[model samples]
Every structure is written in C-alpha cells, then in structure tokens.
Target: MTALPQYERLEAPAIWREGPLAQRREVIVVFGDATLMIADGRSARALTHWSLPAMVRRNPGKRPAIYAPSEEEGEEVEIDDPVMIGAIEKVHAVLEARRPHPGRLRGWLGGGAAAAALALAVFWLPGALIAQAARVAPEAKRVEIGQQVLGELTKLTGQPCASRAGTRALTALAERIAGPSAIAVLPEGLKGARLLPGKLVVIGRETVEGPDTPEVAAGEIIAASLGAAQEDPLLRLLRYEGARAAFWLLTTGDLPETALAGYGEEVLANPAPPPADEPLLAAFAAAGVSSTPYAFARDPSGESVLGLIEADPFKGQPAPRPVLEDAQWVALQGICSD
Candidate 1:
C-alpha cells in the first residue's frame, strides 16, 4: 500500500452497523496502517479495524457511500463525508495499479496464436511437455489454476466454510504443518485431505469436527502436503487428463470442463494413500505433533496403520507444543456452522 501523506491520520464521522440487524451507532473513523480504524465516538475507544484492500463500497455514485470489509461480511459503514470517501477511493486506485494482471503477467498463459505456435515448436512427448508445464508454472498461474479447480470441486462439495475466527484458527494450524500452505475445509463430498496445486490443501468437515483434538487433523494436512512434495498436484491432474488437457491449459489458461467432468467425484472416491512412513513421521515430527492419534484415526484397531502407531515420533512423550489452544479448537470445529 502506498502511503498518502496528505491523508495521514485523516479522521471523519460515520455511522456503523456492527451486524445486519444491529442498531446503527455514531462512530469516529481514521486511517491507520493500511486499515480503516473504527472507534466508539462517545468514548473514543477502538471498536474494530478493517483491512483497506478488503474494503468494498456497497453503494457507488451515491450521496452516502456505504462500505463494508467484504462482500460477505455483514457489517457496514455509512460514509457521507466527501473528503474521507475521496481519500479511500484514491488509496484503492493506487493499490489497484500495483496489483498484477491475471493471465497476462506470466507463465504458460499467453496471447492467443503466439502461445499455440510456441507449443507446436516444442517437440517433446506429450507426457514430457505436461511435466515441463507443471514444473515451470509460476505461483500466480498455479494459484489461478487451483482456484478454478476449486470452483469445479464446489459443485460437488459446496462452498468451503469461512467463518472469520474459524478461518484464522485453520490458517494457524495449516501453517504449523506446512509452511504457508492453505487448508480449505469443505462441508461435504471430500473424503480426506486433498492437496491441490498452489499449496492448497482441501479437507472434509470430519477432520475438524470429528477429532477431539487438532493433532489428528493437523496430521491429515501434514500427510497430504507430504504426498504433494513427491508428486506435484498440478502434474497429477495433467497426468490424469493427458496431453490435450495440458496443451490447452498451457495455451489458453484453462482446464477443459470435459476433462474435469466427474473429476471431483473421482477424487472423493480415491483418496491418495498416506505418504511413506519415513516422510510422514518426519513431517509429523517437524510439526511437533504426534503420529499416533492420526494412526488411530486411520485405523481404530491399529491393524492397518500399526507402523504409524508403534513408530510414533513423540511416543510416550507429550507434544513439544500444543496443536491448538482450547478456544482455537472450538472455533475450528464450528468453521462450517455458518
């Protein structure tokens, strides 16, 4: 975010609705560290802070410009103050300029015929080309592809639950298991943790709400992330769909719907096997979580998953650190409640 020297410490009067049915209250708003700070006007005490980039105007080209933290968040702010509104608009414009243009910035997504011509010039076998494409894709393009796949999966697995507090807890848990990887918990249809391209890990509600503690759930994330390390999720999809799918995606920046038809169902039915015991244990150890709970979760009798139980890294010892706090665990279990 670019600093607006002129708008530094800009303050304005506004009315805030904390929720959809909450009564509107007089408030004082100011700019603070790329966030919009709301305060109780009577006591001048802090109420909440909204991220600048996440702010969206509910009503545009209107006298009282209504802004909310996001389209889904129900809270609202009525800002009729012209100067403050202008300041916000200016900040958004500046941030927009800095944002990358999708499909145009980098990677295999290219300009029409030019990409097609390049694709033909590469004489590598179909399998080889698909492998090459997956390996070379940039982070932005990978994320875009993963998001599109997620959209397709949603047809089978509703929208991923994202209550504010629940999402925060899930984020912390995912980061602990795998550096910066995101875990999206779906309400239904997913059988287990599915690692997607762009470091996205998808899980079913059972992982969160079924386990008494987060250790088992964290183990699921760890196993999926470990599997993804050996076989890149993007490459796995490309392999399943074959050359045509890879070629089209590289040239047009999309996965063919026909290729993805019933793909979600296929994934749900055939969950990836847990990673090799060596790596799985290493990952569990690195995360400071026990492997035994996950072992039992996989096989209650400890017959099929005896190795994970007996070879547990933290065997007979307490976890080096807790998987989650009592409050964080409670919130995560309710992630899909809303």
Candidate 2:
C-alpha cells in the first residue's frame, strides 16, 4: 500500500509496549498508508511498524485508546491524543469496510476448506515441504511477512530513512532498476544491500547518500536484485525457522511471532553472497547501467573486482539513460535528513 496523503505529515506522541512483559515507552507515531509507524521519541529511530488492518482496538470510546497488532494478543500501543486516535480509527474503519462481505464470493471461499486441506495433504519430505510452502505462499501474505521481518530489523538498524520527496524518488528508482520491487535505505545498521521477502531490498544509507551519481546506487540495487533472482528469500526464512515453521504456515495460513522470532538477526548475521559475474554483467548490460561503479564500490583498489572492471558493460560509452533524474537524485541524497 502507498502512503496516505491526508496523514502524511501527521505525527503524535503515544505509549508503546513491545510485548506483554516489555516496559511501556513513549514513542512518536506516524500513519502510513496501511501501517502505524512507531519511532523512538528522542532518537526518531523506527521501533516497529504495525499493520492497521490486523490491529484491534482494546478500548472503544475510551480517553486513552489501546491497540494490539493481533487478535491473539501481542505488542500494544496507547494513544491519548484525540487526532491521532481518530486518524488510526479512520483507517481501521475503512479497512474493515473493505472486507469482503458475506456474499457469493465469501461463501465460495468459506466452502473451499476441502481444497485447502487437500493442499496441506500434498506435503513431502521436510526439505521439500519447506520449499512447497514458500512456492505457494500468496503475494499478500509474503508482503505481510516481509514487513514483520523489517520491523524486527529495526531493533538493530534504526529507522529507515525517508522524506516525502525522497521516498517518491526511491519508488521511481526501484521501478526503474528493479521492476516492481520495493527498496529501503536505512539510516544505519546495514553496510551494503540485503534482500527481504516480498521483493524488498534494504540498503545502507551510504549507498544513496555517499554517491555523487545515481549509477553507484543503481549498481548496488542491481546487484542485490540479482541475488534475489537467484534465491527465493522466503525460502531462506523458512529454512532458517526450521521445518515446523513451514508446516505451521502451510496448515494455519500464518506463522506465529514465536516462529518468526530472531529472523531479522539471522538475516543481518548472514548476508547472501554476490551473484556470479556472468549474470551480474548481463544484468548490467541489459539495464544499460555501468558495472564499473559497482566494482569500484566493492573494491576501490580494483584488486578483487578486476573481472567486473575488465568485463564492465558499457565501459566506453554512457548509459542508455540516466539512472535517475537530477531532481530525484538530489532528493534521494537527503532521504535521511529529516
């Protein structure tokens, strides 16, 4: 979902509790298109992003409204500001209204339990079952899981860098270089690029802020996309969580927080190796982006990445098109400024 225009600039103070036993700390809340962004009040480092649709209000018509991320009970946030509470309620109302009402479609879906059971019965060996789970997971569920993992990453990375104009530029850059994928630039934590589920890639702010030309950032994103193309990130998550996690997802349609715990740390600890040279060069050649910047970024002395530098596509000529427009690049540079 995209950022909601009406509440793009709206932010307020609220009490955030990470879990049932965690201490309640004051946090700054911002409304995104379909999520509630909670950030540290002092540092402004993002703490967690809550899905509004999955959220449930614990206190209705109460002065200080409390909300939780799931029906089974999980992290909670309390808001006293009337405007913030109203904005949150408004989005929740719309999402609830948009639910498929009890009709022919809903009835048909409800009656399809046999098909679901059939699917679950098609499992294989432990390794194959995990692969099958990831293979059949729907896009929406994949995106939801991706966002959850991203929030977990906040514990170590701090908030992702974003500004209205800067985010717009980021979206354009992602579409330009990586098809319909989403890319995030974090203020800190990541040193390079890390692929997340749901076609999301999180890169260090340096890739965007340190480069004079967008070509460098373009190269980083291109390389990350190449890694994702080679391996399904969802499979990585399932394999990390073990076979039981995949089985739960196949039977219950969602993984519990317990099942997903520590996944962010796992990803940060073990990043995927760069894609092979042949495919990397081919991708660079096809996108009309130069591979020299990427090679240089990896090894400034040009010792290790000599192959990329030597076989660099478009070495003698300019790219087919600029990676990003001048204005877009300028905005991207200041993404973390706010």
Candidate 3:
C-alpha cells in the first residue's frame, strides 16, 4: 500500500480570539508539501488561493481568525470547528517562528553580491581586459613592432655562442646574486616576460645567456622589477587602454594584441628603470655583488651614478657566495634545450 503524504489534518484551537467581544472562529490546518494549509472548519469559507508561504507572517502573534474573500467588498465568514481551530493555531505558531527577517536576509544577499562585484572590478577585470586587447593586435604586429626593436641588440659586440650551458651558468650566478627575492627576468624576445600577480619573475633565454656574470643579470632584473612595483603595471595598462577596454578584459580573458607589441619593443630599447640608491645598495649588499656594474650599465657617465658609487657598500667585502656548482650550472642551461 502507498504511504500517505507527510502531513496531518487537524482542528485549529480557539487562539484566534481577540478584542473585547467574544468573536469566535473555527479553522482547519494541514501540514505537508513544504507548507501549512489552512481552511474554514466547515470547508464553507476556504481560501483556495492563499499562499501557505505568505501565512508565516501570522505565526508570532495570537492565532488569527480564518477569513475568506467574499463577493461583497469587505466581508469574511467566521469558521467554527474545534479540530480545525486547534490545527490552525499550531500552523500559525510554526510559521511565525520560522519566518525569516526580510531586512537581515536582504542585507546579507546584497552584501555578498557587492563584494563579488568589487573583487571582479579590482583584481579580475584588468588582466582580462589586457588579454582581450592582446587579441586585437595582429600576429604580424608582434613580429614587426616587437621583433624589430630587439633586432637592434644584434649591434652589441657579444659572442654568437648559443650554448645552453652558458645560459645555465649565468642563471646560477644570477640566482646567487638575487638570493630569495630574485625574480627571473628573460629578454623580451625569448620570454614574453609576463609579470604575473604577486611579482613573480619570468625569465627568458636572453637573460640567462646574454651576460656572463649572474650579478649583472640579477641586478638588471631587480632594477626592472622594482620599477614595475613602483609604477604598478596593471594601473599603467588600464590608463593606456581606457575604462571601457579594461571592462571588456575583466569579463573576458584576452587583450588587444597591439597593446604589448610596440610597448615591448620600446621597453627593450629603453634602459631598465634606475634603482633607488638606498634600496639598490641594500640589494647589492645582500646579493654580495658590487653595485658599480649595474650603475655603470645604466649610466656610463659617472656623474649620473654618483649615489651607487658613493655608497659602494661592498668597498672591501668579499664577493657573493656561489649559487651552484659548475656541473649544476651546465645542467640548468641544458634544461631549455631538452
């Protein structure tokens, strides 16, 4: 045999009585289907369309009388049934106790949505916009604007060696110089050098192989990374692209391709951001490398590099510790080749 629905039909109690004169009423109640159903004791005054969910408002008060809409403008027939009256009273109690405060609930829901929207506005949107903008740039534009600028570096009188081992050794040395805070900085060509959130370092082949000493490379990375922090790369991108373009990126995950094309080229040709003397001096000291090399690289004119020259914290100190064994350096350089 099939089981009955999880509800009980019962008489409502005389709890609906209120005011001076004795205004008696009868009611019936049913509990099932996720709501309490109410009706007149004789079924003569049933309100077929009253929402049980909406009846929860009467729970906290004295049991209210069962009233039915009438054809006459404002008339309600009284109900009179002991069982029905008792059931209705119980139903009213349950409803009022469980009624959720609309003000509190609305505040909670609105706050959560606002917080999510704010997070999207601040953190998520900018990167998405840049990625979207990046898509707009023609593939050829990267080749022309970006690649052409890096080609100028070929003018430097460096050896044409392509040995991965050399790059590894250089990386080892740079890591040694950078210590824990070192960010991996690669040349523009081989590494897209995307500065991810939280100042992570992205290295490319050129950074590893272009210079012999790790200190020089580490110094350059430090300089450039510091500049990025001070300037806030994300802010710069938003300013360049405008608010509407940035909004597109937050909802979507691509940037106009042209955004990075010419900019990357310009960045390569331009000297890395100059290090602040006090901070750079500390960094150089911690890395155990002389700041002189980095200073000179930035400004060959001694006049401009006076602070690094003057501070020269390593005037008589021993050189920085080695970051890797010669064999490890060799292996690291070959990692890219494999």
Each prediction's TM-score against the native? 0.62, 0.63, 0.41
Off by over 4 Å in 2: 1-124
Candidate 3, superposed: residue stretches over 4 Å from native: 1-162, 177-214, 257-259, 269-272, 322-338
Off by over 4 Å in 1: 1-124, 252-259
Task: Point out the higher-scoring one by TM-score: 1 or 2.
Answer: 2
C-alpha lDDT of candidate 2 relative to the true structure? 0.79
lDDT of each: 0.78, 0.79, 0.45
* Model 2, span 135-230: residue lDDT tens: 999988888888888888887889888899999999989878864378888888787788788888888888888877888888887887788677
What is every candidate's alpha-carbon RMSD to the true fold? 21.1, 15.8, 23.3
Backbone clashes under 3 angstroms, per model: 0, 0, 37
Please state the error at residue 306 of candidate 2 in Å: 1.4
Write one digit per residue (lDDT tens) for candidate 3, span 47-122: 3333333443322333344443322233233344332333334444444444465666766666655565454334
Candidate 1 lDDT: 0.78
